[model samples]
Target: MVDIKSWIFKDCCLVFSLLCISIVGITTGDQEVLTNSWLVELSEGGEAAARDIAKRAGFSYVSPVLGSDTEFHFIHNAVPKTRFRRSILHTRKLKSHPFVKRAVQQTGFVRSKRGYKPLKGVLLSDLHINNPEIGQLINDEKDVVIGKDPTDPLFDKEWFLKNRGQSGGIKGLDLNVEAAWGMGFTGKGVTTAIMDDGIDYLHEDLKYNYNSEASYDFSSNDHFPYPRYTDTWFNSHGTRCAGEIAAARDNDVCGVGVAYDSKVAGLRMLDQPFMTDLIEANAMGHMPNIIDIYSASWGPTDDGKTVDGPRNLTMRAIVKGVNEGRNGKGNIYVWASGDGGQEDDCNCDGYAASMWTISINSATNDGQTAGYDESCSSTLASTFSNGKSTIRDAGVATTDLYNNCTTTHSGTSAAAPEAAGIFALALEANRNLTWRDMQHLTVLTSKRNRLFDPYLKHFWQYNGAGLEFNHLFGYGVLDAGAMVYMANHWKPLPERFHCTAGSIKKEMNFGTNEPITLTIDTDACKGTDNEVNFLEHLQAFVTVKSSYRGNIVMHLTSPMNTTSMILSQRPNDDEHKNGFTRWPFMTTHTWAEAPRGTWTLRVENIAGKNNEYDDGLFREWTLVLHGTRDPPYHHQDADEENQTKLFKVKRMHDMAMKN
Candidate 1:
């Protein structure tokens, strides 16, 4: 057999070397040099000539492989060879010039190109008061059983019934289900997709509420949603995550979910080598319908570095979904920030670090304490196991796949899904809200006073306010109650207004009842594709009209197309169906207020369709209406100036207009 250990060590060395080079280059200002930086091959024939030109240009690093290309990072400072000389000694003919990639421009860090590591471990007994070993660890003398045991005499078949309470089970833990229910979120009609190892659908606590219709097995392309029999160690990690989000309660069982009534759908993608990409593609294929909130507990190493390769494809797909997929009826993508602390050797924070998605960090049971058991010195506990288990006092508790009720586990991984469950509740409470609306409300509603200290010392200082939205706690442990309040009442941001036409030669008649237009001569719309055309125009001149007294709000309701219409009826079905077929249409008439507020008009494309579709099919239009105030204005803004600034930002919106 091949030496797996040696191979891993070699890969580590490669990563270390690249990291060192990047660090050294950045620290020494040598990053400005072309030779010392990462290089990308533009053309084959230009290899020798490019090298000579680069050498003459004082460039250091050069690579022919596109995967190894670093040209994207330094594109801002890169001097095009054509701008310089033409002779053999001073100039070089080009096959392909090093073009900068978009990621580098956006993030400044080079993406890692590493593969996935399959989880390997066994299922242990639930670590509760009943387990002597666990009881001793936490110094508990009382006997407490959090879940049911298959071998126990009290185990009954009727207990396995859907939505039934656990009669023979211990009165273990309460996941604050009543609070969630009171917030108007029962998770009814909502689906949560779990991307992790295969789930034991037969587990008593999970079986009742398990969604047989939504579960999918990406491990072997089989229709069976459960894990393969050969994988003897199929633990309860996925199952526990499911329970944390939607486990039924009230029948005297151990625990309950934040959204107990929500449906749990499993998508197993963590098993086998290089399965991450496959899982991501499968989830992306589902788009806006199959799943609403994607709860992911597993992530890269805790070292806080990114990796590249096919896995990037999945990241790209997720970003695509966040930006344009689901017809702008965006789905919430939740990722566990990782349990590793600053001292962990592997700097492996995965998709969480990406700005495209929301990263969830753990908090202890009090809903206020630290969720993971950090070392005395603030490092990740060395004994932390990635195996299937549960930890109760740490604020997280769940069932084990082995059917033994003797074990409990703790980790940021567990805490992440707990938050995801709360998000499910928020979604259920307010099904009319979009993904962005939900996320902003959650972050804004989170208490800044409850901020958790990060393992990396720098995060606290680098992140302002030391409260809301630190890289460590990520809006400080999601507040389900607060989120629900905002979800049910919050409104969408107003569409910003700008005059794309150089000057309105005609006194724009924006209707007497509409909001007035403040014309400014800034090139805000210049060079932008945000222009409306009667036919085939890249840009257009338009007016935004708003009514501040009616229930019709100018909510950008669809991601696929842009149009304007009047809502003459309540609960209109056309509101959901009028948008592009690929995206969910924003329900515009649901606002509490009728036509009254500031509205904006600009030129942009309807992006709800897939990239493969013809761009010509999308058309732009003018917008006129009124609606509710921006939801996050009061919470997210530090003051009135900040609120005004947010209001002034005019995005080239191509939202499907509501009728």
Candidate 2:
């Protein structure tokens, strides 16, 4: 009666579908066992059907996946004798359901907070005290004025807000929030959700602006997202980040926040035993309509070797948020560039390099790159973090745990929140700005000012669009005043389009010290619906194998002769078993450049003087260009536009003649 052959074929299909499930060795209480949790993606409008299917399958229905309408998380209490049998049976049962589209068993992955660890010589306590010289510097710079400055005790020490050569720092090398504040834009009606350990919402400085409706604790499955108290104060990170964004002004608490009037919500998902894909998805997708910005200061291990990013559910949630969130205006996601220093490359970390996120880098108050900063082309802009000098308050001043305050908040973690707060101010000025619009504003409004690579390893160079960018500092440090002003007068960018310019599927090999240079001449899909005349972001999807992955380096040269060091040397990434497979290495260094010329990519392995390893294989390279046919900026000259139109008409005529 049972067709064994047919049953086997069906079971194979079910197994393939279930491959979406992330398999990791997770041990619970010294026993390796499944979590008994399943993430199921059902057909649209299939909630009632999902519930009925769950009941028939001897499972209990959980809430809808927080950020997804068609996905739900379900639980099972039945314990079969063998985990493999149970998994197989459950996979078949879920697949048999007419409403269930896909199902995956949730597994755990290690997600690290991007905070900087203690350096060998730096004393954390040295950052807690304000230098007496700072007050004198502020007083001496009377010409540099902010209207009716906040009276918070630490306001003067908040040099990132208004740098004036304090504590061995350069003058006017700050976020320029004062000018925006003077213009009366204090992030009045924006909400930014901090997805981290937890926020000390009850703190005096943060309580007034804390948004409970947008807060959730996926770690404990509750709404109260308060940090768990500990003697080590390990969970004070989220609180410090919150204060950087929405700490109340003139409250005599800590220094005033960048957007002191903005609302801050806590999404505590990191303080758990192990992180799951569903948890990450829920945190990102939670209340996207209500929460305008999601500030993430964490990612995969910054140890230079680990290459990890969002899993299935989390990836879908992020896509959904950008496509459907904020009433379809799009949710702004600000991510901290990795803190792997010279050892790690942010491009290897998918979250920071993703096109969906605005990857933020850190600059010191002295207008130099921090010693621990990673060099990557994906970095969009810079924000002030701590410096190496102990002579001044080298860390960010923000609220800490248990109604306390600290002046030592450091790392790209601190830098990301500052950008989030600035974006909140811009949002308050213009609520209709889309996610892409925020990025465009960042590129247009960021300033070079005095930012430079102190090591001189990376120099600022002008792209084809005449926009200066560097691997270390991106477009340059963020100018809050300029950003807010631009936001007020900004028009929505044209509908975005992407064109796959070229791909090389054949594998090629290169010897040590001998570089491999590949070229792709593309018209950027001319005379097509997906034509991208102006470039916003360029991605090189590469699949390569190396004996020592860390030694591999890549350079992408745009048609404008602007070269972007997309993949930098990582001394710590020695992963030999598996090299990059279809990893999308992105770059903002070529922003607004034309994508219609000969693009050159140079891949090399400089294995030091010893020639340490054997040859590496380059399997594939695919170039994708994202932009609009029309120029996105008003600064484009009339001549350029005339040329673009003429080219379009000529190309169309030629195509018609061919037809």
lDDT of 1 by residue, 127-212 (tens): 22221111111111111123322222211211211112232222211233334454346778788888776677776556777777
Give the lDDT of residue 367 in candidate 2: 86
Error of 2 at 591 (Å): 0.8
Best by lDDT: 2
Q: Specify the poorest-scoring 10-residue window by lDDT in model 2.
A: 18-27
RMSD of each: 20.8, 8.0
lDDT of the candidates, in the order given: 0.38, 0.78
The residue-by-residue lDDT of candidate 2 on 147-251, one tens digit each, is: 466777677778899776876678889998877776678999899999999998888889999999999997667899988876677788888899999999876
Question: Using Cα atoms with residue i matched to residue i, what is each candidate's TM-score against the true structure?
Answer: 0.48, 0.85
